[model samples]
Target: MKFWQSVEHAVTPAHGWAATTGAVVAPVFHYFYGTGRADILVVLLVCTALDWVTGIQAAKKQDKTYSSEYGLSRLPRTMFFLALPALANLLDRVMATPGFLFYGVTFGLIYHTWNSLTANAHRAGWPVPKAIVNLVETEIKAKTERAMKQKEGK
Candidate 1:
């Protein structure tokens, strides 16, 4: 009976892959987030996904070019930025610091990504607030100025 059960279990196929994967990942997630940080991760992921979908729509509408290759080329950067919160969490652990840097940088990235998503949505013909768009432009201008100054100094 035990041998038959073992064989049955083996042949039944694994429905627990997702569960097993989550179990494996749970420790790593806890190691970084400790607890109560799932919201940050969720927001970042949601923003990234919306941004990509809107990006495709915007490109198709405005540029009339839906190039998967171009999108794929940009994917690494998108993924890296998306993963910055994990780096922040790791930094908090290793440096024995308060999680301010983690929250600050991650929330900032989330905001920036959401802003991009909104811009893409607006371009794709959705009505986004003018103020929101203006804010994005202002931030870009400030960043550009800072970068220009750095270039000049160099």
Candidate 2:
């Protein structure tokens, strides 16, 4: 067997798999986020990862065993995070709202995840400043209130 033939044999399957995955995933991503919004997803994913790491550290700090089951529990929450924005984007399109619902839902999820990350870091004995924590809580509260008011008005 020639060296180039072996190389092609090894790479071809991986390339096909990647291409197939991209074909499916790219359309779904564009459907949900359109264009120029992947940063939102990236940030949310990064925040979730940081939160997971901090949660593990926090569990260790408290002398608790971090279970794989607990880690796997994030799957549903992550799905919710993704689904909410997609739903909101659909609503925005239907309502002709120009990305308002999508951005709001995505940012809200990001903020919530950030809050969780900070709490986990604090639990892990990190010196998470009180002011930062308070600000997050305050913004969450304000957003909630505003949303409630909007709902009431409607």
Candidate 3:
């Protein structure tokens, strides 16, 4: 398949940027920091579980009804953690990039960890790290309660 087709096929909600961040990038970082391959898998699983728990928390906090779609979308993302190495190997063969698997894992772990941090901080009314804060301003001195007050006062 062509590159666009590959991207299109991969562009489901489950395989989108958020899931990649949570499953791939987060685990990749742990792997980079001297984690063994097996340990990296464990970390990926942990991060996926964390994603689910956080998703549930967010839904509950918002009083939103959970859908089967949400669960379905999440499953493939978790699976991507396991599949990425193989996929990267294939890509490596095709692109002549030797470290494709490593790149895949490292990027995925980094993405997920940063995403998790940002989401948790947002939920808690705190600021996430500037490195992954996206478009939001990073307010250093404002605690949760103060942020809430400032938000309400606005």
- Among all candidates shown, the one with the greatest TM-score: 1
What C-alpha lDDT, on a 0 to 100 scale, does residue 129 get in candidate 3?
A: 58
The residue-by-residue lDDT of candidate 1 on 1-154, one tens digit each, is 9999997777643646867888999998877665788887888889989989987887677556666776898789987886677788788888987687789888898888887787777667778888887867755455345435644554
Q: Report the C-alpha lDDT of model 3 over 1-154, residue by residue, as the tens digit.
A: 6999998987998767788687877666544333345555566666667666765554444324445665587678767665675566556656777665656765677466546645645554444555555543332223234434534554
Write model 2 residue lDDT over 60-103, tens digit each, in one string.
67435556775697789878877898899889989999899999
Once all C-alphas are superposed, what RMSD does model 2 give against the true structure?
8.7
Which 10 successive residues of model 1 have the least lDDT summed?
A: 139-148
**After superposing candidate 2, which stretches have Cα over 4 Å from the reference?**
1-11, 63-65, 134-154
Q: What is the alpha-carbon lDDT for the whole of candidate 3?
A: 0.56
Which scores higher on lDDT, 1 or 3? 1
TM-score (all chains, Cα) for each model: 0.75, 0.73, 0.45
TM-score-based ranking:
1, 2, 3
As for candidate 1, its clashing pairs are none
Each prediction's Cα lDDT score? 0.76, 0.77, 0.56
> Positional deviation of 21 in candidate 3, in angstroms?
31
Which of the predicted structures, 1 or 2, would earn the higher lDDT when compared with the native? 2
